[model samples]
Target: MTSAYPNGDSARDSQDVSQPKQSLFPDAIAIPPEVLARHRALVLDPATAARTKRGNRPISTVYRADSMLIPLREVQSLVPRPGQVSRSEINNELAKIGLQLRPRPEQEVIDGAPPELGVSVPLVRLEDAPADRAPDPWTALVALRDAFGDRVKHFGLDHLVLSASVAVEGAPVSHGGMVGGTPVSHGGSVGGGTVALHTGSRNPVALLMPQPPRPAKVPAGRRPVVAVLDTGIGPHPWWSKHRPGDPIIEVSQEFQDLLAAQEGQQQNPTELGPLNHPEDVPNEIQPLLGLIDSHAGHGTFVAGLVHQMCPAAKILSLRVLHTDGFSTEGSLLLALHWLAKRVESGDPDEMVDIVSLSLGFYPETTDPEKVLQVKAAIERLTSLGVLVVAAAGNDATTRPFMPAAFGHGTGSAASGVELLSGVGARNAPGHTTAAFSNWGEWISRWAPGDALVSTVPVWDGAALGGIRYPDGGGLGPWMRSAPDPDDLRSGFAVWAGTSFATPVVSGLLAQALAEDTTAKTDMVGRAKRALIATDAELARRYWQ
Candidate 1:
């Protein structure tokens, strides 16, 4: 296959001299000139530009699978080693090079843990110092890592992770729709306010019904909880039966607080910002208009899939990604740390058995320890018996997507742990690997992900893609019209990605745990013992 990065750099095995065969799928689809211009226009809009700023830095909304984004002048590092190097000593060393650290107290401290999970500090480049042009935050980070070497293993770029969805032409970023290069979805005309999938010539019909009642026989504590760290859940008919005060689908206050801390006082509480894709705006690219964000109902769809396979499981919804399917590595790390804390709390009501992460990003460096902060957060959860399930991404490459790819390595936390499961996507009919699904030895399992039906928000778009006919001499609501592709009043949608597939495995794991007759108190221990068999059973049932 061609190099995953546009610049022809591979994230893994860079030293391999063997020629790589070309795959039929393209890494990126060619964006039409018109669509490209539309994206440029949106970027220049004042309202849109205002939303992209994280403090004084403007976050990049575009998706480049090969590259990772960190705050422009910031670097993340673990707490300094006491004897080897103190924080003050490190700052003093940086000062010699015309740089200093501005520690982030919020990100550095986890409520239950020491004030040392990891710290993202601003890297101020001194004007009078050696270098001519200011080095990008990533460049500065590499210098620091090289200087410290093995003494500091947990420091590097804080990647801006994205949903494992297909990138489309004219759209700001990939959210499981349209096609730029790798054709993940066939016959779908997306990004111009059209439906994401083209099942036929008609619009998708949502299933207008309430979700089936939950099985009441199983006690609340026995129901395994799967935490979905994606877009926040939206209003949907499927969840109507859930009782009041029940957190069947709710936001994670802990994660929200951490994110607020990261963004500082400029954070917008009502809207998830500094990490979202634009949806409300109409540009030349999305002319049909009134389209919801590409990945608006992502969390709802994922929650629906889990409920379908395992109704008894309680889903803990954590809003990490914006409706547009963009998230920061800092936010993801915070979410993971929160999950670890929940598992360690030993409170059955607060524990999560399976964590479904439907998003990931590729790191520029191949060394596993360089991205130690992310790997360590995931390891902490696994050590506490929480099962981590991550999407293998939709880039259709073997390049290691972090957190998911971490499942393949060996280290202090992963040496003998069997808790991490990396999942790839498959089609439901033939049960074969989807063409767009990332695959390799690192991927632990596969499941049906393409064209799968699930619940979505009960919202309608103003896009008038189909023919419309007015009633009563053009003075009333339209009596007849062609199907509106963006109209999701049906409260259901068909989406494809490893993002969807990861949840299938998570739901199945929860199902297995709920069905187990073993002691429920030690949920962590129970999950650890069942994970290996669960992995094998999933392979036998889905991959055989």
Candidate 2:
């Protein structure tokens, strides 16, 4: 029998399900030969070129600027005790090799690193320096590190990686035997205005149903708050109509630069636009519009999953990944620092209870320093009572992925963090883990990731009919038109990935925290309990 779970090819049959699909344009899409040639130069490796034939991959674009992180504390330690080194002294030393340092923006500061360690700065504009005098970016970074030793802390190329989620086109699988009824969409007013869409029999929300009402005695102000860090949450009606004011938090200009660069636009500070709409490029060049990368609307989809389980919990949408679903290690660190700073400085109202990271990188080197830096950041966030959840990755390998793997480590001040692997949906026979989920002892839990339906950015009707695939395949649109008059595919999609599995755990933890007053004192412990309880509940309802 065909598996009930989508993407449920047995692990024995498809060992490489976690690998990204080949480029949408197996044959080159239309573009000027010169532009295509220039794009080819941008590909960093043969593997990247093979996977990104149409040049939509961020790592294969001009934005792949070489950058390295320098720990300032180590640099400061190089000077004699009680002596101070001016910024110029550092710059002058770097100038010999055509490198420079600048202060990190205040908004990116967070408790990830000790204040005594000083801020980690990026080594920028290495290409502009005289080639003969200036060594390659990596060489210069290494020379500086050797000269300074541990005082330099860590030094390496700023690497790029994509989000873990994958968006697929189709209807979601049904789970009626366990949960009952097709999932229905719900609409409610916010800010005193009626929501544009309504929940009805024909328009059931996908993947989640409202929880039965909690006891009246449950404590107020203890709802678990979830923060989603991914591509910017698009302006989806479900979130806009449910939450008053803007649903997304404003990001800093430095963050904006990262997005702009990824989109292949001018990266100057003045040229950068807001993260929500970074540029006004045409569909041909816009990654999302062209379907060059499949990660568009990733954050919105993740938020939708969290909201489905914990409708009343506060959600903070932070955009870190570009539309192409790519971000550098430096960018990810900056985002983590920004969130940690808020939790550290903000009042109780602003503190976050859970952080969902659906994105991660596979380091090129085996050095543990970079991983250690990320671990420190996670430790810092958990230290402040925030639970961190990460996707075990789509690579389907036992090789550990960072942040997710970090969840298995000890010594953190708080201990609510864990890695989630993807499993097939309810009652899917013979398939436990989703074919795409990475696995190892490090994975803390598993959740259904196949054929998950959630929110997406509503597309303008212009593209509703369909767009012809560039290769002349019959009209193959990125999104299909809604069949039911009341149901709109414009604002929803069915996708599969370990990235989605993570929020399932986050939402379950949120629901558990919201109902259990006793768990309030130790939110991290509460999160752990919730994960165990949720696993049991799923097993009872579906696994048996």
Candidate 3:
């Protein structure tokens, strides 16, 4: 609901309220004021201070977000009916709470910054937790999302940034009734020698597993390389495809910033790596233009989907989103420039095969300005021979989203050089269109969404353990119904958004590329054509 650039950022709106409010950071573990006062005292306490001696500090606290909500009625109560606490008085009180609430642990996490200086980025969904902390971590996260409900934003957590915590086991309602897993063919998806993977089942991955890819004739595991420049990825089982030994990867900004720096330093030109780690490659994978104002985990989720689509592919997960979900124009410009520089270098070390983005360039710009950036970036990525895939956005009422709407619209032949693909979401047998799905005529391909489950950090899962009262988005109770109804693994979820849809298409797009060895640069164009040319249904529905 809050999407304006910041003279009054969403952060300001929360601050506009009266005092005694709880945190909006989803993982908030309430600490009584007395407890906080005690903790602060201990930090500066001579005795407590001496215990650490010279060491910086230890992570003694863990966030326990019992609930991610604050009743709207509670907030209404704080609104001092009309004449009370004029702006100046309100300002004084807010200034007071502001100072204290900030340094608070949950507050930092609200910005996607951990309370502790080095708490590796908090993973959002269960499928996206670190290897050691997968399923359980995600459980905690959902519990948190549920706990907060509409109170989530009011508590100061990133709006639209949520963790999905479904379980990934067999769906009793959907496992094709194949007992002991006789290997359902995944609804006609063959996974050998790059066959297309068609997943229309109600499985945890939102994807029915494709038949495993055949071992290369010579068993040559020529893994594909993929770069996901988004918020961040925490180690998760679904992410295990890229693992040489173990694959659930989420790159740290610490190390990535280091990788982003040209090897030689400020004075020297950027150097292509013998990319030591696969995670290090996303920044260098494609020409990243800039960061968009999306939540941190949004990028992380996109990264996870790309990895899911191409398990054999090496992934470079780039963290571009900020806590408030704002990435400056400069950041995106630099991101793109780096990719261009790497691609033009032509060094094998700098070579990248593909890039998929679930984000768009800055909105609010003139059509020409938007198109110029899109055209140029597509041109550059094409020149470098990198296949670029982007989301069409979730604006269901309009034409397909910007870059995808424009880029895919003109087609490869018209663009002449670069090939771009725009994807839309589809509702499968058990699925319904995402209430918020952005679709229409200009739409290209429809993959899937509408309660399609994916990944999120564990802690949030535990917090939002059950379905929150639907805030009016037509949220279904499938998450809580059983026969295990949808049989979603985490036992609770029914997300509605294009964010989910984009990833579904993203994965399939990668599958298309992975299938062809003599892959052409225009593969993206060809794929676009494949969907558009055959979209009689689309034509009848909206293009009439």
Q: Against the true structure, whose lDDT is highest?
A: 1
Kindly list the per-residue Cα lDDT of model 2 for residues 1-544, writing each as its tens digit: 1122224334455555444332221121222333323222122332433221233322221212334454545434333334555545456667666777544344133334454322334454445686554223444544555466554445444555467754221112121111223233332112333331112111224435443233333354455678788776556556544334433233344545543342333344322233444221212223243322235567777888888877656677777765545555666666676677778875776677788888776553322334456767777787776778888676445554666766543222123235222222221232355555665444655666656678766543222222324333545445444433213345666566777777877887677667665636665676566666666655554431
Task: Give the Cα-based TM-score of candidate 3 against the true structure.
Answer: 0.44
> Cα RMSDs of all predictions?
9.4, 12.1, 21.2
Model 3, residue 141: distance off in Å is 43
Give the C-alpha lDDT of model 3: 0.36
Q: Please give the distance, in angstroms, between residue 144's alpha carbon in candidate 2 and its true position after superposition.
A: 3.5
Off by over 4 Å in 1: 1-87, 105-108, 114-116, 127-135, 168-204, 208-210, 219-221, 244-247, 265-290, 367-369, 408-417, 471-477, 521-525, 536-540
lDDT of 3 at 35: 26
| Whole-model lDDT, model 1 | 0.60
* Candidate 3: Cα lDDT at 247: 40
lDDT of each: 0.60, 0.51, 0.36
What is the TM-score of each predicted model, taking all chains together?
0.74, 0.64, 0.44
Model 3 over residues 432-468: C-alpha lDDT tens digits? 3332334433344454544454553221211122254
lDDT of 3 at 352: 52
- Looking at model 2, which ten-residue stretch has the lowest summed lDDT? 169-178
